[model samples]
Target: MKIITYLFLISFFTLVSCQGNAQKKPKSEQFEIQKTDAEWKNQLTAQQYYVLIKEGTEKPFSSELNKIKNPGTFICAACKHPLFKTKRKFESGTGWPSFDKPIDGGVFYSADNKLGYKRNEVLCAKCGGHLGHVFNDGPPETTGKRYCLNGVAMNFIPTKK
Candidate 1:
């Protein structure tokens, strides 16, 4: 009887500790722009909705934004919140739009363990739209942080003369 009780206590503590590490997602209402699933689906194209709303990734090198070399700002497709500027963009050879940083308060991060390991998931601060992950592998001369993003999740607005 005592053995069984000890086992139960151990299990309970283990579960509680693990739950502490789980990420807590912010409620939709916390965002600057909130919308229902149907509303978001109606507003975004199929691909954009997939990456931005569903937290899905796009095929590497598939986005035309990857080839954009002009001066511009990348804004969230869901809310038009400014994210990355052309000056921060870099060629990471990873077939994604890589930036060393984002505009102030333009994005946020959450712990992502969907792959059975830990990763930092980036999201738009205004709309809570999933952008992509950030990594430490970036240009050393720069910020040394890679804000790898999905092109379908954003639209580039070229700077006007």
Candidate 2:
């Protein structure tokens, strides 16, 4: 009986270890590409070109949509792809634009930021364009996420009447 119980325990642990390994994803699978400076320049706008391509951040509260409380869709400034919906917008008080969730699979996350602060870096899933970082400290009742984005990296499309 003692030997049988030890074998059962080992088998259970092995199954759990295999399950964990199966769920682990490779780093390459997280992001699609690493674009060159010229490639990004050719794809983004002057403002987007500066922020996303150059890794620059826009001034807080400078975005026209920062105070906009109307229904709208936020698209990638580089590709104009729909990324976030008005419903996900929230006042995160982080000074930059914030979103609780992204529109479906519009964005992809990867390990980012080299400031010694670990954060999830968000990017335009379609074109892999840089958007910003996402933090866990956000409004409750939702995903508890704060997608702090650069205003220059996005363009707001107000909902049509």
Report clashes for each candidate as comma-separated counts. 0, 0
Off by over 4 Å in 2: 1-36
lDDT of 1 by residue, 48-121 (tens): 99999889999999989989889989999999999999999999999999999999999988888776578999
lDDT of 2: 0.79
- Residue pairs that clash (backbone atoms under 3 angstroms), model 1: none
Name the weakest run of 10 consecutive residues (lDDT summed) in model 1: 19-28
lDDT of each: 0.91, 0.79
Quote model 2's TM-score. Answer: 0.73
Q: What does the lDDT read for residue 156 in candidate 1?
A: 96
- Highest lDDT scorer: 1
